[model samples]
Target: MASNETPRQWLKRTAGRGARWTRLSVIAGTLSTLVLLVQAWCIATIAQRMVIDGADFSSLTLPLMLLPPAFIVRGLLIRGRTICSARGGIEIRQSVRRELLERIAVLGPFWARRQHSATLSNRVWDQVDALQGFYADYRPQMLLCGIIPLIILVAVAPLSWAAALILIATGPLIPMNMAMVGIGAKKRQEDQFQEMGRMSRHFLDTLQGLSTLKLFGISKHQAQEVHTASESFRRRTMRVLRLAFLSSTVLEFFASVSIALLALYLGFVYLGQFHFGMYDHGINLFIGLFILILAPEFYQPLRDLGVHYHAKAEAEAAAEDLMPILNRRVFERDTDQPAWQPEASIALTLEGLSARYAGRASPALDNVTFELHANEMLAVIGPSGAGKSTLLNVLMGFMHPEAGGVSIKEGTRPPRALTDIRPDDWQRQIAWVGQSTVIVSGTLADNLRLANDAASDDALLDALEQAALKHWFDALPDGLDTRLGEGGRAVSGGQARRIALARAFLREARLVLLDEPTASLDQASERLVMDALARLSSGRTVVLLTHRMELLALADRVLMMDQGRVRALDTLDALRAPQGPLARPAATDIPERRDV
Candidate 1:
């Protein structure tokens, strides 16, 4: 993953993680080649004694008896290679998946929002899975290509140097031709990977928004998009296969031509038209037959390598997408570093903080400064693109400030910079609930456990009751144990949001960050969530981002932001003045601070 490092190089570096099993596969393959030489020698001796020497059947007993066991041992060795290779593939995949998940965790939810969930899932599963065949078959085969062919050449050189020379000459053709074909194959494979991710993301989006599409009469348009993507992927796949077939053809031609040329030379030597291949004398039936048999073995490794060359291409293409994520430099935070401690309630301060997206023209949070006293509620109101979410992201520890900083203090402790704290320690004290809640494929209890893994059944029930979901829970056929979420039973959007609120309750975090928690809920759902939120927020610090001006009344102060800059910060009563930015909100939506 160094600058200018190729994908193939990255794959080799990754291979080191499971080198033990790969080494076992290599050992078995090498031993199998040696056993193959023994078997070939036995075949040649038997043919020579029977055909040329006119020996009786009884004299051939030993060679014939040794043949079956050698075949069995060779089969066992091949099986051992397969077993070792599979284990190596599993280890490599496990290592890669763990790294990917860890990277996502470190990047945090704010960064993850910028990427497509389906695309990330493809990287986690499909892209990583594509490497299995390479580690399991192509890697060991590539290594044996180097060692096995050399062994075959050595065995043949003593009997027929001309055949060995043919092997030496023709061996490069298969790999050289394969390399040429692989150049184009790799480009196709990379394109395919990209198309696959795009298609997956597209499909997931279409499915998730199917109701919206139907409402707008645009479902047909999305269907056509899917068709277009599917056709493109199919054509790309066919092109890769065509290259694969061409590579195989090239390998077969070179190997066949080399073996045929050796056969002709052995025929001439037998017919006494040639006299120059043997070490001490003219070629005999045993020597010629052994050399011919060993000639094919010399090219076998190269042919096997040709067949699996596509796997190498596939793995490299997968690595092309994966290496950047793995090699991305992350700030190393010290576990033992001193960090600010907020006790009893929360006190927050931001100073001249600035942050920007990768390709943006301006900072998302530009020199924004703010303060909130212990147990205070701050409502951040902004038009879209106004640093409201960015401020919450920084406070929630999902992102760090690019310039300036944030600090926290409680009681008599001195204010300390957020960067001074371990990220884990900072996150432990904050509970975040975004607009949408993710319900994974699991049981109702399993989904709830994601919040607090050790929460007892009674604790979970209590949390559900606290979220106003006690009736919902009781109605389920199996109660807490009932299967829910996808692949089980779907819950309404309200239930999902409440489940998130329950997590916040279970966490008992001192700071509560809500990013438009009631944005898309129905009137009843919104009321239930607000009631739960008020309970969760009471006596704890709260930073709420919303456009709901009615909800602003619940806050001690309302901060207005525009174009990443704070426009105003004041009490809701003050903002409601005719000269202030706020327009008075209707009381029917939400009435009192405590009732919110």
Candidate 2:
């Protein structure tokens, strides 16, 4: 079932499962508090026996002798609580990170484009790091702090109601002061997170585009911009630190004052200068010492909470940043039904298609129309920015048309809009080879198996032969098993393109879409690619987008697009003849194949 809960709610629900550990930790904490109270009681009892009864050191030592067991119990509980808190911290961090990744996967390319890579990285690492405080310290300490104070008050009330009243009244002041000072600190921490995300994104952008900057001789200027962003982030961090210190200082001041006031009240009782109704016994050295030792313990959690409050604020700020991308709606229509089957042959039709990019004034493709028949090879030739790539994207279902839609004709179905078909289904029937070949980090066989996981070694060899990459594979020390570096950077550009084509060949899809299949190849390699393409297209539907005349000549029909519309669609000879749109070829034109 789909969950309607927001991210924060989801986090709460997931964290609540750790209630078992929380309960265990609280039990240990309470046991530790009891041990402390026993130690205090033992001290008071021993002192009363020593002073009031005038007893010798060896005569009355039972209460003092019980201290060892209490100390041992306290030590074990502290260690166990620490372990539980650490486990909870790890669980929350991992759970939140996994949830974020799953949401991103569901959102796909639509959500990815809206977010900066570095910003997302920061949220996953830096923002999630802040949540350690929430799980590790704040949560556990809050429980312990509340429980310990109540236990203290209950134990002391019967013995000295006036002392218990004073302790309870001043205890709340620590947290009250924290809340008052922490509000502004939390706000500042949130702003600091935003600035850090912006800085990270700017740095990533600069690094990714460094080659372009160097080519244009503007690298230094871009470097200066990075420096400026870094400086801005540093300043913001400093502002956050200043607020943090101020909040800590304020919390400390109030906690110290409260502790001092409690001590002074106990001192008056110790000197027999004051007395509470029905509790006339003066406070002794033992009681005074107990109160002094417990003073720091009572205030320590509040101080820690002040610090963790900033961490929670930073985490929430990051969550707010990532929430929109996770919540974004991508193709709103349902696609739960099984896919339709394509017939033996496929035919594509686009009628009155128009598309304008988001936040753009002019349409990239306007009123575009075309028809590609079954088992026919069509070549779409155009200049840069002529909407040739846009056409391919729309056909592949990567982008939706604003006005009319693409349709596929199979048999008695008449014609069904591409949007009506599932993208995964349509993609399975098609083999796409583009200019910038993507080579994942793996062995040659691993990359080849991406198209058809069930492909045998023999089938992979056949694909390599078809792509003219068999010789290259043979030269490798491990043949198809040789590892490729990241993005195939270890191989030449031409080799990477051949490997990509080999992948497409392995798929053996009925519809083959080649976008500049021979762009990176030499003359000999180009001929080999063209021959392989001709052989592959013999019994399949092929759509080739290129400017090369030799490849265009193989097309059953050539489409010449200008400005977002198909200006001509006919035989290559007819289009190249006098009075055709591309009648005159420039001298510098190399007739290279294009890729979308």
Candidate 3:
């Protein structure tokens, strides 16, 4: 993982893998450097003839003409380098984001529940964007810093070996200074990114719960907490920025000192005081002019590297958060494996099933055993926190069990472990309706078609009718095309529940799971939902969790659960028998039944 990798090593590894994109950028930068060399030679030659040799404008014509084109070409190369770098950075960002999204989808709800929406958003957006400079600017400039200075040294060697020696000797000092100042930069930037994430999460949570805070008259207190968090984040961000600024200042200082030393040495040679390293006709106008002009260009790439170094630090920090997610182990599946297609009838068996969550004291499902026959409807009855929802999550492949396993048995075929089933296939054969409806901001038809994107308008209408929502849509001006939910028309609690039911009805799934689907509905709404549910459950295996006695009549059998264990599984009449343990009023009294 990049978390354990050194910042330099991680940067090199990721940048190396993207050589196809970055190669063009490096080539462009090198060509630009070569063009600058030609420009410097042209300027030096022209100056020498005009000043020392007493040449006229006619003698300077060719060099003057060559000068403009060199500058133009150099400018064009710089633009090309910028373009190539941006494209490479964008390509890398897209690839990484795609991989992260695919991993999140495979990890399912269990992993998603563990992460805050704000934290994940920060990772996918801000953290990913931070890598742009590393791929585009830092990687290419790193190469140029090494090669360009060597090119300048070689160009100076023929004129005066003393100057070449000075250039070579002083070049290492800038990087040495930059390295010393940049100590712990990666860790600091990582901490900065973390603080930003925390700030984002805190703000989002506070904003979402604004109404609740107002109700409790503690909105001011929460606001103060948010302000405090923002201040902390601001201070941390400044620290990282300060470190970057200090690194840049140190690099510039060394580069300036190196150039000054070269200038002083050239001045002594020109004065005829130091003449040891010069060749014949040494330290004349042309040689002195050329070497002096090229001095800053020699240190230019290093200065640029110092500037791009912050990008490396930022990307390293992002990678520390990014790599662990990419390296996470999710549900294993063979690439060549086909989707699992169930028959018209589907039966499920659970053998000594047990599942637990991290850092939890007790198992969510404890040695639970049950068989669901094909086309049978079973109602699960249990108090709050009795593992009803956990069972559904396990059945849907969202959560993995710690011990034992679930398998599907087909007619005359061997039972296959649920683990053997591909996620896409398993999900294709099942539909779910939770207690609270998910009303995304979209058209009524848009929301309905989410269950089956390929479903026709007629199919959607049929599902809506089955869920007892046909009248509501029919009365709307746009009918099934009516816009609803957030940012659209608001829907009541019962209408939203029916929409969720309609989504399930629209699916071609052979199995259906409903978790407290009618929990908060009034009698009228419950009757409507139950009517739609009864029709929807026909020819499908259904597992429902409801407190409504009327809904239990639809179940072929009832499963009683307490403390993660199944206490009984029997026909409703059998369970309701006077002598039956599940017949107790405390166990059987649903809200509606108790009021009755």
Cα TM-score per model: 0.93, 0.82, 0.94
Which run of 10 residues does model 2 get worst, by summed lDDT? 587-596
Q: Write the per-residue lDDT of candidate 1 for residues 1-596, one digit (tens) a residue.
A: 48678888888988999899999999999999899988988999999999999999999999999999999999999999999999999999999999999998888877787889998999999999999989988998899989998898878877777878877887898888888888788889999899899889889999999999999999999899999988988988888888888888888999999899889988987788888766786688888888877788788888988998998999999998987777777667777797544677868888899987778888999998888877888988766677777787778777777798988887787877788888877787888788889888888888888878998988888889889999888789888778876668889989999999988888777888888888778899988998898888888898988766656767888888878999889998787787766654442133112101
Per-residue CA lDDT of model 2 for 65-147, tens digit only, reads: 78888888899998998788778877777877787787676655434656688988888788777767666666777777777
Worst 10 residues of 1 by lDDT: 587-596
What is the alpha-carbon lDDT for the whole of candidate 2? 0.76
lDDT, residue 190, model 2 = 72
Arranged by lDDT with the best first, the candidates are 3, 1, 2
What is the per-residue lDDT of model 3 for residues 252-292, given as tens digits with 9 covering 90 to 100?
Answer: 98999999998898888778789777888678889988998
Candidate that scores best on TM-score:
3
Candidate 2, superposed: residue stretches over 4 Å from native: 1-80, 110-116, 128-130, 139-148, 205-225, 277-295, 339-345, 409-417, 487-489, 535-540, 577-579, 584-596
Show how many residue pairs clash in every candidate, following the order shown.
0, 0, 0
In candidate 3, the residue pairs with backbone N, CA or C atoms under 3 Å apart (3 or more residues apart, or in different chains) clash, namely none
